[model samples]
Target: MKAISYARYGGPEVLALGEVRDPKVGPDSVLVKVRAAAVNPVDWKAREGHLDGLFESAFPVVPGWDVSGVVVQPGVAVSEFDVGDEVIGYVREDFLSRGTFAEYVAAPLRTLARKPGNLSYEEAAGLPLVGLTAYQVLSKVLQVKRGETVLVHAAAGGVGSMAVQLAAHLGARVIGTASEHNHDFVRGLGGEPVTYGEGLGERVRGLAPEGVDAVFDTVGGDTLRVSANLVAPEGRLVSIADVDVVTYGGRYYFVRPDPEDLRRLSELAEAGVLRVHVSETFPLHRAADAHRLSQEGRTRGKIVVVVDWDAGAEGGSQGV
Candidate 1:
């Protein structure tokens, strides 16, 4: 199978296109034929060894987690899906390697969900990770309610965009932080946009004079510190970017692969309540370019890497 991988932790330059052995399927897994994969900041971070302490690494690691594809084969113990069923997944493991940036991936049933009928493979590819993060944090962690005011940082980015829409859907008045250029984009996502930087707090205060009921911090460091001062009394704060949030009476969250949650996201998409904006896409062979774009950290939405199966035939035979 052809895939993008790196033998050692490094920069985008370390990633290369090559042929590798096919993934082995477990009894509780499904072999998905790759159609598209989404690039998240975590992909580049893992490539550079930032997550070294968290996950065990396997050499020549395939660096992707979000995937939209078709089930080619189901494991012996699986009955939830069969050949030809379209699916999407946050196909992560406790260890690195066997990822979704390949011709196929052996995804555990817990990470798989049927793809939403209304979304293209590229859009669906971008949903699992960011959508799950926003859903878990807003719906479960913050418990945002109707009439409450919620502030989301980096609102034009993947998870932030999803957070804005979801928070608004829950009836919260959402205030999102973005650059001047992205204010309209943020507003389109159902958030009142506030430009971030020096006067971020004041701007948010302008929108919610009493301070916000909840703050969703996607940008950490100084931004996280500043967010603490902008939360209303008895309000909540959560950060997915920095663990230091704990010191400020906030929770630092990590998204998990939940099948039911992914299914709900799919349902939301089908119902037109949620949508993933695909800002740009690259073919699988140019995955390194995708990483570079994501690292720039200024994209309005998801960046995707598509697998061209027909192009694969000209390069080499696929495992499936």
Candidate 2:
């Protein structure tokens, strides 16, 4: 299979496209014919060895976690999905040795979920990691409720976009930060857009007037620190940007992917309650370019890599 990988930790230039062997499936895993995959910050972070301690540092690592694919064959013990069901999932973050940036990947049944009927392969591929992260931060970690106000930093980002929609669907007024260009886009997604720059705190204050109930910071640095003061008493502040900071409450780092969380997101998306935004698409071989664009910090939403778009599939082009 044609794939992109790096033999060492470095810049995008280190990535090379070439052929690699297919992955072997374990008894608890399913071998997926990868149709589409999504690139997250973790893809670049892992390529640079930023997560060396959490995940093994193996040379020639294929860097990607989000997958939207079709099940080609299920392991002997697997019963959650059949051989032809379309599925999407967050591949093994527990071990970075294997990844979804290829023609095929073996994913555990626990991380896999049925793709939302309303979403396309490219769209579903973009949902797993970022969607799960947003769901966990807002639903699990923050526990946002109706009639409250929540502030989401980097509101136009991959995770931020989903976070804004999820928070709004849960009945919270969402204040999201993006540049002037994405203001309308954020508004369309049910958020009051605030430009993230100097005087961010003031802008958020002006929007809410009353204090913010929770602050979900996907962009670390001052966004986290300054937003801390804006939180209501006993409010949660979850930061996925991996910044070290002092706060009265909230969790840091992208938490582990949870099955129940993915299930809820699936139902929400299927029911038209949750929305996914996919801003760009690249071929699987261009995984390097996908990483470059993501690291540039300008994409409005998730970036996806299409491994194969088979035209013979049921509804349309099922990429697997």
Candidate 3:
């Protein structure tokens, strides 16, 4: 099937729109005919060999994790879904290769969840990775409770935006850091906005003078370090962006797929407690453009690649 793949780890330039063999369905897998897939920073980072230490990728890797599609076939062991079921999944496998940036992906049941009936395929595609990251950070790592003040850095971003909405829905007083341009956007998501940069702590403190109950950092490095000073005495802190957060006694998380958590996100979406924003979309063949936009680090929401393959037509098999 036609897909975007990289022969070796490198930049977006290394990505090519081509055809590769369809992924084989495994026991406990569901073969999905992808309608849309979202781009995450990890996708590009993996492409650049930054994640090579973690995942020994095979060459000619299709790069993506977030997917929304219809099930074409379900493996023998799978019972949760059937053919023609609409689903969204964080399809990160133990290794790289069989990915969501194609017309088909064999998604393990562990990573799959029913897509919210209220959401469009693009919106559903955008949710799995970032939504899980935000939800897990708040509910699991931070344990943010009602009436607490939570400060999220880069809160207008993909994960951060979801964190803002989830934190607000949890009844936490949400404070989000973003550029001046995104302050209104953050406010609409129920967060009080603070511009991020030098004196970020002071700005956040200006709103909650006693320090916030928790800090969620999606932009790491200096932003993570600076926010460390703003955590209240009883506060918890977590960073999905920084490894150095450990130095500050904060937990750093790499997202793991949990079917239950994914289902909860879908529930939240269906209930209007969580919403996904797809700021832009590219056709599947234009995946490199999606990666380049994500690399810029300024997109306020998710970027999705729409796979417009026709089921009745012959799938492309041009690039071997």
Candidate 4:
């Protein structure tokens, strides 16, 4: 099958499209014929060798983590799904080496959930990584409560978009940071958007006189440190960006993906309480372009890569 692969880690130019052997499925695994895959900071980070400490890789590596696809084959021990079930999931989290950048990827059954019927393949592909990140930070680490005020940085980006929507759905008053152009988009998602640069503290404080109940930092650096001061007593602060150490009421967070959290996010999407925003979609051959756009950090939402083995295909890949 044709897929995106990298011979070495460097710039986006290192990524190339070519034919590769399909992966083999293990006994508790399901072999998915990937229809769409989502690009995250982690993908580019791994590609550029920025995550060498975490995802040490050899040559000829496929570099994507989130996918929406259809089950083409089910391993002997996998009773949870059949050969034609549509699913979306993170391929590997315990180790960041194996990912979902190809036409086929094998993943454990527990890591996947049924794709929402209301969403297209691109939208489903966009949800897994960022959605799980947002869900875990708000529901598990922070324990965000209704009537609380939560502050989210990079409010117009992938995780930020999901965070703002989820926080609002939970009945929490959300204060998010994005550029002036995204203020309307954030507000439409039920968040009070503020410009991140300049006096961010004063702006957020003006919105919430009492102070924010929790802080979710998707853009670290000064934003994380500054958010520490905005947190109310006993407030929780979580960062997926991993840029700086964050302390809020003596609490700090580094986000990780969990199968249970993915399941919960799937439930939320199925129930119509969560919505995914996909800003762009590219063919597998254009993986480098997708990486470049994500690296710019200016995209409004997620970027997806669609795999089209049959050039003239009329519809989305089978069940997905």
Most accurate candidate by TM-score: 1
What is candidate 1's lDDT per residue for 27-94, written digit by digit as tens?
Answer: 99999999999999999999999999999999989989999999999999999998999999999889
Candidate 2 versus the native: TM-score?
A: 0.93
Task: State the C-alpha lDDT per candidate.
Answer: 0.93, 0.83, 0.90, 0.83
The sequence of per-residue lDDT tens digits that candidate 2 reaches over residues 81-166 is: 89999888998656676788888888888788888888999999988888888888888778999998989888898988999999
Total backbone collisions for each predicted model: 0, 0, 0, 0
- TM-score ranking, high to low: 1, 3, 2, 4
The TM-score measured for candidate 1 stands at 0.97
Most accurate candidate by lDDT: 1
Task: Tell me the RMSD of model 1 versus the true structure.
Answer: 2.7
RMSD (Cα, Å) for all candidates, in order, is 2.7, 4.0, 2.2, 3.9
Cα error, candidate 1, residue 6 (Å): 0.2
Better of 2 and 3 by lDDT: 3
| TM-score of model 4 vs. true structure | 0.93
- Model 4 lDDT-worst window of ten: 311-320
Ranking by lDDT: 1, 3, 2, 4
Would you give me the overall lDDT of model 4? 0.83
| Structural similarity to truth (TM-score) of each candidate | 0.97, 0.93, 0.96, 0.93
Name the regions of candidate 2 deviating beyond 4 angstroms. Answer: 247-249, 309-320
Cα displacement (Å) at residue 150, model 1: 0.3
Residue 73, model 4: lDDT of 94
